[model samples]
Target: MSTPTLPCPGCPGRRNHGQYLCRTCWRSLPADTRGRLTRRDKRAVLRLQQLQQALAARTPLQIIRVSP
Candidate 1:
């Protein structure tokens, strides 16, 4: 079975259902932000919110940051 995909939140590309951005857009994000987003701890939801807010504000991918 293949994973379902949807339009990426960060770009016009498609991404896996559970992913936040397409591969290219995800890679464009800073390493620290990537690490924080991947950590499924108590702050995970907040981190996702931060990302969404940044995207909504049209922040550049390379400088986007989420809470640690």
Candidate 2:
């Protein structure tokens, strides 16, 4: 006897769909891996880190316009 389960949102994981992703899908996520990033994932992470560093190094820009 087992409880009813639903199809995973990300993939067809045969588990309960209480969350957005099932356990299998969650485990398969690239971000969840430990020190084993693929080349593409690593590049993406590095790019994001660079963007964050650049943002932190500069002041935010603001624009104001008035019309009469």
Candidate 3:
């Protein structure tokens, strides 16, 4: 079985199911931001919200930051 892919919220690329961003966009995110987003704690949802807000505001991926 293969994972279903959908359009990435961050860019025009496609991302696999259960992933937040496509490979290109994911790799473009800062290491700290990626780490925070990958964490599955209570604050994980908040971190995802922060990422979405940044993307909506057209913030650059390199400088995007989420609360840790």
Candidate 4:
């Protein structure tokens, strides 16, 4: 029978510990520092795309609302 494998990738040059890691470093990152995209960033990109789409459709609307 095969043994139950853990998440710890015990590979050479790998860092981290625990079954979810290797055998060196650990996952000690902030909840928000995990390259999480901000809502404002998403909104800005979406707004830009909407603008481009409207321009392509030749029906652009001028609407700007400041968010607190």
Q: Which numbered prediction scores highest in lDDT against the true structure?
A: 1
lDDT minimum window of 10 residues, candidate 3: 1-10
1-68: candidate 2 lDDT, tens digit per residue: 35538764444555553433356644554452312222355365564344334334542211111111
**Candidate 4 Cα outliers beyond 4 Å, as residue runs:** 1-40, 60-68
| Prediction 4 global C-alpha lDDT | 0.34
Model-by-model lDDT, in order? 0.93, 0.40, 0.92, 0.34
* Per-residue lDDT of model 1, residues 33-55, tens digit only: 99999999999999999999999
Question: What's the CA error at residue 57 for candidate 3, in Å?
Answer: 0.3
lDDT of 3 by residue, 1-68 (tens): 45647999889878898899988999999999999999999999999999999999999999999999
- Each candidate's TM vs. the true structure? 0.92, 0.31, 0.92, 0.28
Clashing pairs in 1: none
Report residue 46 deviation for candidate 2 (angstroms): 24
Distance from true location, Cα of 59 in model 1, Å: 0.1
lDDT for each residue of candidate 4 in 1-68, tens digit (9 for 90 to 100): 33434543322344332223232312332224212212357455554454345435644122221121
Could you tell me how far off, in angstroms, the CA of residue 30 lies in candidate 3 after the best superposition? 0.5
Ranking by lDDT: 1, 3, 2, 4
